[model samples]
Target: MTSTQRPRAFRIPAADQTGAIEGDVAPPSTVRMVEEPFEIVEAADGTPVPVAPKSRAPWLSLLLVALGGLVSLGIGLSLERMISDLFAAAPWLGRVALVLLGLAAVALAAIVVRELAGIWRERRIELLRARAVEAMATRDHTGAQAVVRDLAALYAGRAALAGGTKRLDTLGDAILDVDDRLAIAEHELLSPLDRQARNAVATAAKQVSAVTALSPRAIVDVAFVVFSAVRLLRRIATIYGGRPGFLGFLRLARSAFAHLTVTGGMAVGESMLQQALGLGIAARVSAKLGEGVLNGLMTARFGLAAMAVCRPLPFIREPAPRITDVAGELLKGSGAEKPAP
Candidate 1:
């Protein structure tokens, strides 16, 4: 008797098909790719997650390090000379200077500790993401379970996730498949945080758009943009459990920029601008309002990059945030959307 395999559904191939396999990676149609291709792998969900290429030598990091060292050395020397002069001038003044120095030293030490902790938190997120990727690649159920436990621990303190965290804790002996487990973890743990992150981004975009439109001076626009960006980065990190301090924020920003470069996010950002402009045209937006839309688009673009960096897990159970989605929301709230007649 002859036996035949059942018919299967068709998909547009991203690569040439061999009889045995379609391609080395998942199809691009399944994944929402940015301009650059980082090579796609199927995520915990059927959709693929694209990994960005490693960036070039970290010149920004080197510059930051050199500048920090130089400033620190200059400050130490200045303080020492000040204390010496004060002591020579008067004993009481010297005692006062010493006391001030001690207090400053303690405060400085505390700041250093917080910065290190922030860096560690960012690193921990990177490690966890890597682990999940590794588990997905290898189909290592044990490793995936461990990753889930670690993720649970990371969000244990999040009041919103308390119930999900407890449920995740019980899944160790329940879920068997690696992808299924990871997907479940993402659904339970990262879903609420994803909503919050999206909200933060949406709010920041609207604020930047509003401020830029109304501000008469370029400097005002620049200052507000910077302020909003820094706050948005911190808020995104906090949402994802990064809790980055200043130095950590710098590191986070660098990673976000790297991500942007590798993913060709700037081009997509341009696409966002184009989309916004299209909306603006329909609504007969004024020149100033149009400019505001572009500025808001830029902020939203960078915020998306930052969101990608801060996210602890890859997009598994949900679609990654698209520039168009955020821009649509931003435009609808502003004067860009067409008015109902």
Candidate 2:
């Protein structure tokens, strides 16, 4: 079937369905959401959304540009006047002034180049992080691993540049330590989890293939899939020392809430696919498929986020059992993913 025909399992529901889905998003149903002390407003769908901290981007940019322009203009004017005066007064002194000016210009240019390089390097690091997350979301372990290696290499370069300062060395060491552990996590955790995810998704796809339209069974299955994914995420997080305490579970719920947009987008795309396919499939069927797939993917994302937020210590030893080993171990006797043969 076309990707569009897939269920939108990840989409967040309406404000009303928020409660039902919230439980499935994270566990410990007793946990209450702690409100952030900030401006709150209603979303388009009438949901109360919190306003995030404002950025001082425009003011900062304007100030920087204005200061740079003024400095450049003043330097140009002063240099021209000084050179003319020096040339008219003493030719030898004028030559010496020109040489000094040239050296100063070279020094300024070097500083500018260094700053630009730093910005470029920072952006490159961010891009690598995005690529790694995308790879994890798509369950591409090899791609994720490659990205982690690149990240580790970048951290190594930073460490080399850190040189002799104790604080810089410590920061560099911490970064390298995290990246190294991440590299190990890729093999020890992500690899097996990916395999299990494929199995889970395939099994889910089969169960929903026969659905011609949304039905009670379809709805129940959708909830089941979501809840299962959430549980798996919690289990994965716990394995890495990120067991969702009341606060942590609340955090997870908020993150999982993002699935609404993901699933909704899938639904929109699925509708378009239905028209294109001209197979007379019911709109509800396509919508259901999209939701399922989206939710499943979101579940994976939640797990990854949970792991990061929990900030568990790095697993330095490869092939050694971490806080827990394998999905089976994390899941205990819950009959999650069966042991790999």
Candidate 3:
């Protein structure tokens, strides 16, 4: 054991620990080459699905229906219990309860009907608008006229659109050009409504900017922003003659928020670009004021997106308002301008 312990293992220095052999030469000088990325147009398409779409399971829909039914049943039972207790207590009380319940039920039923009707109308408008856009794109004369007729029917009884609807009716089929028909519909009909819609959007944007700027609490700012955005969407829909019910508002919100999502990147890029271009409006203002201005711009941006979604027709004649346009107005209104510059 002592004799074996006398031999020691050889150790290499940490600096020379590389796996290079004795005859190996140093590697050639490193080249600083950069490869630019390029995209190839992928010609191959994805395989089409042969089966009917079942992305959503049937059980989910069943679950929703069941949940609604359970809620309704619970409410009915509670109401029944209350009414029965009243009856047991006194005949007069029971009679009054029955009348009140009947009235409430009737009112609820009316509201349900109205809401359903509103959703249907909104769906009809959306479909009609899509058809019109496609017709315009394809230069489909017959299809365009059909769209005009449908649009006129949609706006028929409104006193505000009486002239435009009548004009559309009177000019039926006379204008064979798809462009002309769409233009007339957009300008004569949507323009006046467009102005009203813009005014509403500006008002909402102004209010949001003011509230968010003055409010001391972040929660207040957030609450007001959400309230204003929803109210703005609802107001814009109303201007376009859309009676968006709760469900319909959700649909509109989905589209509006989708628009916002797509433009969100551009919004960030725009601010960055403005700074890079030496037009740093944010730099000119105090931090809180800058934050307020940014929030105002975001609100205006959302308002613009809401306009695109809620407006049945595409922005054909009158262009959609730009973020800068709205921001400039907001800045002026709020007295957030650079002082004596």
TM-score of each: 0.74, 0.31, 0.76
* lDDT for 31 (candidate 3): 48
Summarize candidate 3's per-residue lDDT along 1-341 as a digit string, tens digits: 45665667975646565446576577658644324223222223533334343466789889999999999999999999999999999989999999999999899999898889878878887888899889988989988888878777777777998999877777856845787788888887888888887777777777777776678998998998889888988888887878788988998989888988987624556544542232245435545555566666677778888788777788776787776565566555434455336
The digit string of per-residue lDDT tens for model 1 on 115-233 reads 99999999999999999999999999889999999999999887889999988877758857888899989999998998899888888988998898898999999999999989999
* Best model number under lDDT: 1
In model 1, what lDDT does residue 275 have? 60
Ordering by lDDT: 1, 3, 2
- Write model 2 residue lDDT over 163-266, tens digit each, in one string: 32233334332334334435554553344434443344333333333231244566676666556656655555444323454445555556545543454422
Assess candidate 3 and give its lDDT.
Answer: 0.75
Better of 1 and 2 by TM-score: 1
Candidate 2 accuracy as TM-score: 0.31
By the TM-score metric, which is better: model 1 or model 3?
Answer: 3
Write down the lDDT that model 1 would get. 0.84
Q: How large an RMSD does model 2 have? A: 30.1
The Cα error of candidate 1 at residue 49, in Å, is: 35
Candidate 1: Cα lDDT at 19: 38
